[model samples]
Target: MDDELHRRLRIEQARALLDNADPRQAVMLACDLLMAGVNGDAVVALAAESARTLPAYDANRRLAAVIDELGLPELDLPTAVALIAADTCERILDCSIPAEVGTHRLYVVGYEGSPLDHLLPEVTALAAHLEDDLGGRADDDLRTRLGALARTILDRLKAENPA
Candidate 1:
């Protein structure tokens, strides 16, 4: 499929999922990806639009927290994602996740031996989210901006060993 067409398709799928207020993991994942900077304002808007329609229950309390966090004006999604990537990388150096899980996640993205490969999942999720929601409407620089974020996160690593 054409890149643009694929992007549009994902956005539509995500939007429909958001608009319907379904109680499911797909909706939750979409919202989380959006929070992580998938489609930016479109994800934000669609999430907010469907908030009240979301089924009210104890299970939804977690969703409520995510939705509430998204509403905060102080959080910049791209920067936040970069910060998360950097923090997760640090955690690996610090032995946060069990070694097996960490390696699998990192190896999936960092096959080129790039240190910042762990950011791939979040970035991939962002791209997936971007594919559907505002992705179709994204400016030419969206990819560039996202790439810069990954670079920015990597820069913060500042290897003390100096290779």
Candidate 2:
């Protein structure tokens, strides 16, 4: 096969592995792609997008591992927050994850200096209530608030992409 065809095949395989959320295989293939002269930014973007399909903790952990393997800088606080927010919102809205679990993950992730802190006052206010005890004990009020925030983030993302 030509080099371009071979590269395309590898890219397709990487996408398939990522879609399956197989962290180990995906990262290994990402490394291979990098070694083969694929763009690092593209690989990182693909890895980050795939991480969203996982549970919050798992996604963060897996993405961190990928960054480490790629010799990238540590995952910054704001980026981590964004990833967790996007994951929490997407999973909750799709009902793929329970509201309690999603909120608990959000509570754990914390908003801190995230873009949400500046862009969404509601998130900062909500962050005040996010204590360690919020896991199984999350209230309906928390769920409703989180759902609203999730919709807002998703809508914003859609507007930004619009593709």
Candidate 3:
């Protein structure tokens, strides 16, 4: 097969490994791709995509090493937003994290000039409300709202990049 075909196969293999939560194998395959001259950006992008598949906690632990090895500051903007949104949504929906924590995560995703920048105002307002409810009395309502916002953010991201 031609070199291009070979590279594509490697890329697909790496993707499959990551999708299956096999970060170790994915990282090894990514290294091979790098040695074979695959662009570092492409490798990073592929590895970062795993955040969408892996549970948030697991993705955070696993992807950290890959990010460090690749020497990137963080995943690209869109992926970072998606990961944060997904994580916050899951925690809120399950009532696993406090309203403050979910609010903080949403705040991070709505940073100035981020892909979710348009949500900055709303997120900031929600964060303040969450802070008021930090005592846990109003947690359920806040958590539900936060979860809905997170779901909206994730849906927007998916609609934008439908692949």
Candidate 4:
């Protein structure tokens, strides 16, 4: 599909989420709309035209700061997955790499489910944890390898420590 159609579909999806999702989910969707330059003001303007209070406005406002600080990529699918996994690993493993590099191999691994399924809570949590990697994106082959590696590592750790 074309860029305009894709963008419009995203907007429609966000709108549906705003109407039906819980606060946390709605906030994330709202942030996405804002980032896409989807006329957030117009979206919420009818309620209070002058104030321009978009749905989940407070959360989106906070997210704006996060985006400004971390910087989102033009194509964030693979980047988001790698970064999230890396960041999560960094936290869970007491990993030696910089806070930006989860478990060190996280950039070339798996964490995110799929871009097509990004609206899921798990995906969002992964992205947020990535607040800290992404020297590369996580493609399917890489994700598969990473998944097996992660399982092996987890099994070894469990066996060694019994925790």
The global C-alpha lDDT for each of the candidates, from Candidate 1 onward, is: 0.43, 0.54, 0.57, 0.38
lDDT of 4: 0.38
TM-score of 2: 0.43
In candidate 1, which residue pairs get closer than 3 Å at backbone N, Cα or C atoms, i.e. clash?
10-132, 11-132, 11-133
- The deviation in Å at residue 46 for candidate 3 is 21
Candidate 2 stretches greater than 4 Å from native? 1-66, 108-110, 118-145, 157-163
* lDDT by residue (tens digit), candidate 4, 1-163: 3464343333333323222212344344444455666444533322122223344454344434333333432334443343333334434445243333333333323334432233334333333444323344444443444445444444533454463
Error of 4 at 135 (Å): 37
Q: In model 3, which regions exceed 4 Å deviation?
A: 1-74, 133-137
Best by TM-score: 3
The predicted structure with the larger TM-score, 1 or 2, is 2
TM-score of 4: 0.24
Q: Count the backbone clashes (under 3 Å) in each candidate.
A: 3, 0, 0, 1
Per-residue lDDT of 67 in model 1: 45
For candidate 1, what's the RMSD? 17.1
Model 3: per-residue Cα lDDT over 1-163, one tens digit each: 3465343343333333333224554554455556666556646554555433645445334544444554545345555445556555666668787767667766655543456778778888787776664653446677677778877877876787787
Instruction: Specify the poorest-scoring 10-residue window by lDDT in model 2.
Output: 11-20
Which clashing pairs does model 3 show? none
